[model samples]
Target: MSSIKEVSLRRATVADAEAIAAVRVEAWQTTYRDMIPDTYLDQMRVEDSFLHWKQILQALPAAGDRVCVYVAESEGHIIGFASGMLLPEAKFGMQAELTAIYLRPAWQRSGIGRRMVQKVARTLQAQGAESLLVWVISGNAIARNFYEELGGVLLHEQAFSWDGMDLKEVGYGWRDLSVLMASVNAMPTSSSVH
Candidate 1:
């Protein structure tokens, strides 16, 4: 097995949009291969995704809005990214949502994802968000397990259509930011892949 390298997490910038988008697309292709339709995955274009991310990264937040994007870097290359914002309409009583988190396949299960989530949680908490929620593709067992391991509680499920196919999403919620924060903090700092 290849050894994991140290990863540094930092706020994402406009310049990082392309890399972030690439990571997102690659992750989707790998993680959702069986869960999503092949045509949809095949049509996912990096340029389109890059433009979307660029717009999101460049947009100015409205009053009372709390949006953050972060990227994980190792050996001077971006390996993953995560983004979150305060939810306008709280779901499951959660004030914030983890909009997205994606890592390259090789870098997964290396403790980088947990660190990204913890950092996003702390950022959200600082913005006055008391609780957090994340939506995962219902059939994605790996993702579901990852959230559960991080203390997420299954709160709800919703149906949606993708590429003419019906799909479901599972919502995972943390009712208290403090509990999540404390648990993340309790982990040894050395546990980081670095």
Candidate 2:
């Protein structure tokens, strides 16, 4: 395992699609193994992930949504990643949802995840978001704790179908984007008023 001290965060590019895919696959297996079906994971293919990553990197976000991808690199190799996007909503204000965040098992607990998340948050704030959001698997204590430690609050609980099975997900929200940004060493500013 590479040393976490070497990890640094930066904006991802279309050229880094493959590296992002690898980190996604690793995080999925480790983070969602229990939440998702074993059969689904067993049949997962790197090619599919490659295609997905390419698409996300190549396309622009739709409607009210915007995406920003951040990668953590160590010695020129991507070791972790996070993707944040604005969500379409009617009642809530502009929200930056942490669609994905993952670090290699060995890199976990090394502040790499926090750094990756901060990159996304800062990017979103720059894009004009006032709040950030994340949904953790109901049973994922590690993720729940991580979000809480970062000052996220449980907003609601919802169940969704994935791979033909019911899955429980709990929404955790950051009421103050400024507070969340502060934890990441960011000096927060209000996004553009629309």
Q: What does candidate 1's lDDT look like per residue over 10-29, in tens digits?
A: 98888999999999999998
Q: Tell me each candidate's RMSD, in Å, in order.
A: 2.2, 5.7
Write down the worst ten-residue block by lDDT for model 1. Answer: 185-194
| Cα shift from native, residue 20, model 2 (Å) | 1.2
Clashing residue pairs in candidate 2 are none
Cα shift from native, residue 7, model 2 (Å)? 1.6
Model 1 residue runs over 4 Å out of place are: 1-4, 60-65, 186-194
Tens-digit lDDT string for candidate 2 (1-194): 44335556777777888888887787788777877887787777767898888888777444223788878777788888888887766123436788899887777776667767777887788778888888778989899998887888888899988768788989888867888767755423221101
**In model 2, which runs have C-alpha deviations exceeding 4 angstroms?**
60-65, 90-94, 185-194
10 residues in a row with least lDDT, candidate 2: 185-194
Candidate 1, residue 139: the lDDT equals 96
